[model samples]
Target: MPIYGSASVAESGPQATVRVPATSANLGPGFDSLGLALDLYDEVTAEATSGTAVTVEVEGEGEGTVPTDERHLVAATMIRTFAHLDLAPPGLKLKCRNRIPHARGLGSSSAAIVAGIMLADALAGAGLTRTEKLALADAIEGHPDNVAPCLLGGFTIAYSTEDGAKAVRLDPSPRIHPWVYIPQVKGLTSVARAALPERVPHADAVFNLSRSALLVAAVSRQPSRLFEATEDRLHQSYRAEGMPESTRLLHDLRTAGIAAAISGAGPTVLALAVDDAELPEAPEGFEARRLDFGSGAEQVATSRRE
Candidate 1:
């Protein structure tokens, strides 16, 4: 995946700061195609060096589990970006401040990828169009649903084409407040996906199509219509075998008239409510909170030129 663009020179010196938002994918019937960016963030500050070596320091999330050397995802992506631009790889001292939880249905990985790409973008003086960035990040993430929102913010509907991943974004209604219920245990996306059937009934397909179309409306204006719009006959039910608690919680919330769905391929449940609408209590062993939509990545600053 290669993007065509150029960046501004680092007149302020050889450092860049990048920020990307966490993303929630598959808001019910949309499956691997719909997603939204959340307020949570992962930030990276990188300073250029003379050699090709890379060093990373992590704070907050993934402090101990993530790599600190060149193998670090962000570092690797930065290296790839430099190579793609035909620029000599720069050594980097990267500081990552992560707030998004890892492997928990949020787009933590996508955040890192975007951070690296944007780090290179800011350093190269502003390379890569948003479309090109989405393609590169989607290729790394294996889908566009999460990456689209992580790059463009707001609500995104994404699809893959022969050329690459493409997406359209809509500003979600401010009236739409999202409440997420996160279970104590982590659920692997790979495991959840493995639980899905290779095929589904044609009726199921139509069921999803109608509701997914309705979802666009519900997310924007018809808040009361979300219950019907968010209903699905797709992967969620089958994924229950891998994450029964999340499935049960989704059902319980929906039963109470909340428009709920599995967040991404996992054990996190997202409930849609109108602004300030009183939400039900989360079951034991789960944490619930209201999260707002987020804007996309930006270069906050560069080191002041000496």
Candidate 2:
């Protein structure tokens, strides 16, 4: 069965809903190293209404700031999905209630991309596997770290290629606890990416490879090694000039005995907050919750959180 599909589709019920989770990428040593998917969501519901025009209503951070026309990322991606699947255009009544902070290295765009692909699978009955949809979402977004987590849910590591990416599924270990701190400012992925040098010296390049390889091994085996596993020489620290607040937070996290790093090209810092607690014990605005993959069949609508 297509991973994003529902068992039943009611023509006259509530509009189909999609909720994608927030993500923090590049967890320090893990530069494009690693990304942790969070429970915060960006939700999108599309229902058939008495309609001629495809009406879109948006709330939360983006609000009226985003385009409502075909230019909007949501509308545009959905339209693209329909064309790809060769389905007749189903008029969209898109209502978005977003909790994932925008431009905060939490995969807002990835969420948008996955949301469209998921909707196409459900509405038009396109038979798409989670991996298939992930590939499409990654292709549209130019990366997989964000899109993979949204489609599959939970902590994710993706290996991307010209064709697409292949991802490994790991059970959320009970010994691992993720603490996410989102500051009160927006962080742009473009700025994070552009901050990287066009080419690195061979020695520095080897440093990244060594850390990335060890990080992958740690993620697969010793949850204990994550403290040493997820470090990077590639990007996060260099982008610090643009995101000083996060840089300060990183220092604070390390001082507090927490293993913290930039989350997904970050402006958000995700750390291992508690030992032996699968979820965080702290309150919101100080610490964010951790999400685990219940059984691997995760469905996200609109809202793409990878």
Candidate 3:
């Protein structure tokens, strides 16, 4: 018999509630490699249900737009987790209080993926280690950049190894202040990724390497260096064709001596400052908000209904 699971649904333990942080990936030159967790979150509460119906209730972001059944991301993630764990899939009731915006290049999907995996593990009473969670979430998300930071929090550098996807987490400097300018429009990751050339110029690759290293070092110590360190020649320009406003705003912000970059595959622009620089005014239809690096996922509550 399994230590944390039972053969019958009725014997499965209490409900599990998980809060996962939002993340910003790429950070200009570190495409698919660098990410930082944000204070925004998506909270999920999941529990086993009788029969095979999977019901999902979504509030806040993506309310009616997202699926409310097994097709829901959290539910799908749970199903995938169940399959991976070799456990019988059972009915589920999931309530999602989502604050992260969907499809805006802020790692919303990655948060959902992490939430699902956590929910499954929690329901099974499988005490998955942080490493285990990272591995599973990375595999599901197809890259470690976004999911890594979402799972471990702080700033993360991730890459695929022969063994598997792995990441190292670092705390961002207290002096680095983050602001995001979100446009009314949204862009799809698949579309943005598809816009890239199969092969980038070798010089461009070298440019990213130099800048990405500088970015990490700068964010760690020299806050002033961010203006130069966050420069990119890899994917930003390439992705701009689909989101001209985003790229234009990024260029404008940088031209004004503000360290800015397209957030993830964005219509959202990420700007970094020292301490508390006033966020530059956003373009006509965009909204700007200040954010900070976040700690990892938290279990706010767990309860058993007798």
Ranking by lDDT: 3, 1, 2
Model 1, 44-160: lDDT tens per residue?
998776555688999998999999999999989887877766776666789999998787788888899889888987776656998888888888778888889999999999999
As a whole number from 0 to 100, the lDDT of residue 114 in candidate 3 is 93
Candidate models: Cα lDDT each? 0.84, 0.67, 0.87
The best candidate in terms of TM-score? 3
- C-alpha displacement of 146 in model 1, angstroms? 0.4
Model 3 lDDT tens row, 1-306? 242233354454368899999899998899999999999999999988766788999999999999999999999999998887887767788999999999998999999999999888887767878778888888888888899999889999998877667889988999998898988898899998899999989999999999999989888888889998899999888888899888788888988889999999897899998876766787798999899898788777877665
- Please report, as a residue range, the 10-residue window in candidate 1 with the lowest summed lDDT: 1-10
TM-score of each: 0.92, 0.82, 0.96
Q: Which is better, 1 or 2, measured by TM-score?
A: 1
Q: What digit string (tens of lDDT, one per residue) describes model 2 on residues 153-229? A: 66677778766875665555566666677776777788788988887778877887777667666655666676666
